[model samples]
Target: MKKQAYNPYLPSWEYIPDGEPYVFGDRIYVYGSHDRFRGNAYCLNDYVCWSAPVDDLGDWRYEGVIYPKVSDPLNKDGSMCLYAPDVTVGPDGRYYLYYVLDKVSIISVAVCEEPAGRYEFYGYVHYADGTRLGERKGDEPQFDPGVLTEGDTTYLYTGFCGVGDRSRSGPMVTVLGPDMLTIVEEPIFIAPSEPFSEGSSFIEHEFFEAPSIRKRGDTYYFIYSSIVMHELCYATSKSPTKGFVYGGVVSSNCDMHIHSYKPARKPMYYGSNNHGSIIEIKGQWYIFYHRHTDGTNFSRQGCAELIKFREDGSIIQPEMTSCGLNGGPLAGKGEYPAYLACNLFCKDEEIYTPLEVCGWTAGSLK
Candidate 1:
């Protein structure tokens, strides 16, 4: 009999969210922000990794801490927390990890010779004048970084805009040189923020944060978390940096917009901010996302669902399922944990889990 894979593919105790899955050679490695089991804040731990052979999605092995919070000079005392990150293999055949500190607006870079090895601090993404990307006079603050390198050029996608915040324009893309730390082209807004989405295709689902980029054939898929917070949405463009049209939701943590089993507006599970991207493993495409757990938004676990792309290059939103990554339905007989329940809800049918239920405030624990 074959081993069956379940949702929250990692061990139950692990809290790895904002997953960016990539297939480097024969293994698929997942890089994401590490969250504490029951922590007060988001991503309160160092960056760790987990990977598995391309042939087996069920056998995940811990890759240990690939990067530490204190490794960056700006976070010497480890006072700042590490946020969501993305990894790209550079032109030099080295792996580069891009991330931003919790309190800083600049994007930082770390490099390693191998995919899952310890990464050393490289530098901040800056300009020829030596000013960092976010430190420029009129530059927007850099947040979740999603990067893709083709040949010697890398497209860096980043931004964090809250609803009705005019200061933030939207998700922006910048071009980097071969070095991967210096900007070759200035930042340009690919989508509209909530405040500026009046007549745009992204009117209702304006870009919020967590911008990741992937290319399938000739189409560039830009995955992001919209202002809705619970769903991971996507945009498609022929070019890497411009003319992006809003696609539909890839997956929702609370199972919203799925009317096949229940009302479209009804949320079946506790939902919060969702982040992740799509990856193709062994010719199969899956969306890697996270879900709120431990009754709090801080502790998040990763989840993935099989996604299909239409001939026109559109993806239908996938429903949250307990038998994710299994490639098919589970066997008729087996033992499953209660946490694998994808349709979790109370009699009240609450869509979101409130922080008060977990005795957690914005920046402090009660």
Candidate 2:
């Protein structure tokens, strides 16, 4: 086997560094929901997109924002509170972005011909009876916008909350049109896990939101975030467009690693693991998620070791990725300097916060 060099990628935000990432072309595009804790920007989930090109499995070039807050089609008001985003390069050469807006709690999309561009808004999906799909009051379609393609057909899987009369686990599958703008089929119920109370609100959670999908050979696996918004769980089926069964939970149920039930410490506690994405490169699969370092508030960026299936055919749980991973350009790097922690410095600084230098122990720098 060729010992390929490692690319130990870590999480970052445009304004926060905990912004999530996805892959397109030879580069990884990272996007995050903006979080401003004070002033007028507090809790506003605005979004920013960026790209990091990986030439070898060693280093990456950080390209700046491709898209910023322009409009909110769902809210119809243009107030900028964008949430998690999923990017896919369509077979037709256009790039589609599906994201959520916080004020209206609905998922919407915009498309462009280039990987980085000013996207044009497309119409949204609605229920079969013609009621708008996400207009429900409390339970908005939630995290991890997982999309999968089989042949000419594309399917979307998102973690949703089943509010009121809806099924508690939420619908996991909805077919997207070839144009990547609207839904083609009615959304289907797939993952039948237990209900949870998610977010700071901690209301009754529909199951299996924050989903990521991957197809290895003939099997399609749907990895999801679970357990009242803390643990990572997964399900699988042979078909990319069909039956998905619960695959069990990853991470512990307690706050031994961090405190999850309190504010300011929530990200360090137990509330930090949801909204994850997975991608494979050079034969290894990587799980990217968030975690808390102190309390159960906002989550910080986190990743897991590449999961490998045992010879017996069972897959192993992903180990929590840290600054010590033996991959990418920053493998042997030391501590993250204090200056790198300031969100304001990220845009202007020419330095790299190498994966080797990130983690709770690195300490938050400003």
Candidate 3:
């Protein structure tokens, strides 16, 4: 038998010896989030960050609590618990993190000169005019922060729950200062009225959250959870701040692939896939997102899958259990099904060959 081309992908609990894997670099960092089961015991869930080299996911070196609820009385730090976080090596060589500041939905920024250090809170990433964007009075505000950069410009994309309803405020992007601690642009709505965003925990919690963005060639792709907690959908735009059109939904539910309606086993997956991020490793794009785990008590943990891009500029997220890159590298893989279809502008035209009929398979492009 021939050896497999790549290493097998492992989910969080299966990889890291303890806690849930949160971010990755030379090692995968696992962090603990406040799970709902812990009722009134003082919800101060400690976020202990641990790192394990990718070559050996089973062993981890505890990195300690990189960010703890601060002692400040004025900030949510008093009661807020940190949720999932996205870590990035800032252009300035510093480590920047954009993470949810608990149920209140505030997205805060912290920086560390090193990847695994005690991060210091650096105030909110305010709007371009120096005013904090998206902070509404009396509003619990939003959650989850995903940051991206194009050329010399940097944008901080965050989402929040809408008031008087469970639907989310949808994902929005704001420009960030070179320092990454301040906002430099007005918030721009990227996915308004997110299609298929019906009953997902994000929606049930009041809106679509858990947003991840990636840029391929000249186009930008934003992958987000749809209607239910198990569905993933994406939107694409040439400009990060405008004209983003919803593409479609991909299901991680074992029984089906992509669906527009609720199925019986859905909202199940209790290791329901949500919060995720995209990073290019060795020139290929891979998605790292969390899924539900079924221990004596169910919890959410992280997983990785390879992602492919269509020739027309959309992302092709395949279904199945695979490593972070989805199907692996596309350098010489055949052409992707996405490229076979015309640009979204051709959405109204029917002059096209059927998908399965053509050799354009539905996953990471060849």
Pick the lDDT winner.
Answer: 1
Question: Whole-model lDDT, candidate 2?
Answer: 0.50
Q: Model-by-model lDDT, in order? A: 0.91, 0.50, 0.50
lDDT of 3 by residue, 1-366 (tens): 221222123323332111223345566664435343313321245455656555444354667668766622235445665655666667777777676655445566778888778888766666555544446543235556666754446777777433344444467777776777666665666665434345432333223666666676676767666544455566777887877667654334221342334343332222233555555554555555544322212344345556676777555654434333333442445433332111122222222222212222232222
Arrange candidates, best TM-score first.
1, 2, 3
Please tell me which predicted candidate would have the highest TM-score against the true structure: 1
lDDT of 2 by residue, 16-126 (tens): 323345567787666555544322432254455555544343243444444465555445555655666776767687777777665554567777887766777765555
lDDT of 1 by residue, 189-288 (tens): 9999999998899978999999999999999999999998998999999999999999899999988999998899998777999999999998889999
On TM-score, who's better, 1 or 2?
A: 1
Model 3 ranges with Cα > 4 A deviation: 1-44, 50-62, 71-78, 103-105, 127-131, 136-140, 150-152, 161-169, 194-207, 250-255, 258-273, 295-298, 322-366
Model 3 / residue 310 / CA error / Å: 3.7
